[model samples]
Every structure is written in C-alpha cells, then in structure tokens.
Target: MFLPDAAATALLADALATTQPDLAVVHLHGDLGAGKSTLARAWLRALGVSGPVRSPTYTLVERYPLASGGEALHLDLYRIGDAGELEFLGLDDADARLWLVEWPERGLGALPVPDLEVHLGVEGDGRSCRLAFRGVAGESWLAALDERRRLRMLPEPSP
Candidate 1:
C-alpha cells in the first residue's frame, strides 16, 4: 500500500513500537537517494535514539540503544562489493534483533531473509512505499499494523 512520507514513516515506527516482538528485520529496497536512509532515520528517531544518527554506508552497521527501551541495528550495503563481506560482519544468523537494512539486494544472496520488506521509491511529492511481510511473525505483525487490511483499497488524497 502507498503512504505519504510522514504517514509511512509513522506507520513503520508504530509497527515497531507497538508490537515489541522478539525480532523484526526490515529491508528498504530502492535506488540511491530514494529515501531509504530517510526512513531509517525517522524510525530511529521514533525509537527515541538521541545524538547524531548517520547512514552506515561506510562502517556498514550503526547500533543504537533506545533511550526509553529498545535496541536497533541499521545497515547500509551500498558500498559493499561482495556478499562474503556480510558474513565477515557476522550478519549471517542474527536471530533476535531489530535490524533495518538498505540496499539489501547487494547482500540478498548472503544476508538473512528480512522479516518485512519496505519498498521505497521516488514519487511526485513524496516517496512511495510497499510493505511486505515474509515470515509468519511478520505476517502477524503486518496484520496488527493493519487490523482489517483496509489501507490497500483506500484512495490516497491527491497532492
């Protein structure tokens, strides 16, 4: 479904804050400067992460300890040249962690399968996002975000 930039960002933050599930790994797929990192920053801010929050395009992973209560891991793989590098980062079996990864396709063949896929891309005024849940938990998580799955049929307000 499509959500305005603010709404989409809020939906993601709400999903993470409300559910409080064991693990949730979201992958943001899109081109460069397509709002992937923007989404990540919004999410981290919603989680009450203080101090400067920058893209992990260079160091790969940015770990944050939520001021209130939570933990988050954000990763950017756009600079990585090989999938094997993910293994070196020990992202192979991150079983119970909240991770937001960008440029996932670069490490698709190596990284762990995402629980949720938030597809973001350029649009007229704001980027469009498609949220897809992969595993059972993720499906349930999405259901909780959208109780009746009503957002799909609703027409977005024209900008």
Candidate 2:
C-alpha cells in the first residue's frame, strides 16, 4: 500500500494493532529512512502503550508490556554481525506474544519465521508498503484487516 504520509503509516499500524492475533511475528523490511520504526511506534501506541517507545537500534531488542497482559518484543538486528549473536539476546526466554523485527535479514537463522512481513520503501516524500503472509495466522490477520478497512470505507490500494 502507498502510505502518503506519517498519518497514513499510523493508519496502517492501527489496522495491524486491531487485527493481529494473540501471537504474531512481523518482519519490517526497508532501508534506513524507510519508516520501520515509525510504524512500530505507531502500532505500539495503538495497542495502548503509553510510555516512550524507543527504537532498538542500539539495544538490539526492546520489550513492552501490553494492556492485554501480553508482551511485545521489538527487535532491530542491524548491528549484529552474525545470526548466532541472537543467542545472547535471550530471545528464547521471553514470553512475548508479538515480535516486531527490523533488519530481519541479519538474524535469519536465529529468528522465528514471520507470520507477516511488511516491506517498506521510500517513494518521493512518502513511503510504500507491501504486506506478505507466511502462514494461516498471517492470512487471517490480513483478512481481518481488510474487513476493517471495508467497514471504514477505506479504498484498497492499486497493484
């Protein structure tokens, strides 16, 4: 979908926040200024996160406690030199229900296969996003999102 501005990105994030299941892994793909963190922050905010949502660029991963009693892990693997580095991050120990990963390519073998992938790219002054589903969970979430959009009378993006 073509996200014409930050508001558009926030709208997409809101859709994702509402449509997602109890458990999900979402991979955010794009270059440095492609708005991956923006979407993540917006989604977290939409999910009732009231505190600061800092980017995990340095810490590698940041965890948030959700109002629904679940946890969300936002990971940025751009600084990792190897996927094996993930072992030290204690990913296996976390009981997070949602995972939002940036630069997932850097931790391919260490990370879980994403239920959904959001690919973002710069287009003029705005951004473009493409959603790809991996399994049944992802498909269901997309269907829910579509239904929500339809109910809101939002137009579908052109191919």
Candidate 3:
C-alpha cells in the first residue's frame, strides 16, 4: 500500500493494532529514513502506549508495557555486527505479546520468525509499504485488515 504521509502510516498502524492477535512477530524492512521507526511508533501508540516511544537504534531494544496488560518489544538491529550478539539481549526471556523488529536481517538466526513482514521504501515524499505473511497467523491478520479496508472504501448508505 502507498502511504502518502504520516497520517496514512498511522491509519495502517491503527488497523494492525486493532486486528492483531495476542502474540505476533512483525518485521519492518527498510533503509535509513524509510519510516520504519515512524510506523513502529504509530503501531505502539495505536496499541495504547501513551508514553514516549523511542527508536531502539542504539539501545537495541525498547520494551513497552501496553495498556492491554501485555508487553511489546521493539528492536532495531541496524547496528548489530553479528547475529550471535542477540544472545546477549536475553530476548528468549522476554514475555512480550508483540515484537516489532527493524533490520531483522541482522539478527536472522537469533530472532523469532516473523508472522508478518512490512517492507517500506521511499516513494516520492511518501513511503510505500508491502505486507507479506509468513504463516496462518499473519494471513488471518491481513485478511481482517483487508476486510477493514474494503469496508472503509464502501460508499455510505443514503438516508
């Protein structure tokens, strides 16, 4: 999908937040300034995170306690030199309900397999996002999102 601006990105994030399951792993693929952190922040906000949402570029991972009584882990592996470095992050001990990972390729072997992958690229002054599913969970979520989009596109009934 083509996200013309930050508002469009937030809309997509809202859809995902509302339709997401209790447990999910989402990989955000993009380059510098490609809006990966923007989307992730929007998603977190949509999921009821009211506090600051910072990028994990230097810290590696940022954990948020959601209002829904679950945790969301956002990881930025751009600076990771080796996949083995993930072991030191203690990701296996985390009990987060959602995982939003940027630069997932850098932690390929150590990271959990993504249920859904959002690929973003710069297009004009906006960003283009492509959603790809890796399993049944992701497929179901995408189907719900598609249905939501379809419903929104429908014309309103006349009074």
Instruction: Give the true-structure RMSD of model 1.
Output: 3.3
How many pairs of residues collide in model 3? 0
What tens digits encode model 2's per-residue C-alpha lDDT throughout 18-83?
Answer: 889899999999999999999999999989998899999999999999999879999999999999
Where is model 3 more than 4 Å wrong at Cα?
A: 150-159
Summarize candidate 3's per-residue lDDT along 1-84 as a digit string, tens digits.
677788888887888888887899999999899999999999999998987899999999999998787799999999989999
- The clash numbers for all candidates, in the given order, read 0, 0, 0
Angstrom error of the Cα, residue 37, model 1: value is: 0.7
Per-residue error (Å), model 2, residue 7: 0.8
Candidate 1: misplaced stretches above 4 Å? Answer: 6-8, 67-70, 90-96, 148-155
lDDT of 1 by residue, 1-159 (tens): 455566666665555545544677888898886788887887887777779998998999888876654568899999999878887776554443578899888887776678888888877667777778888878878777677443444347464
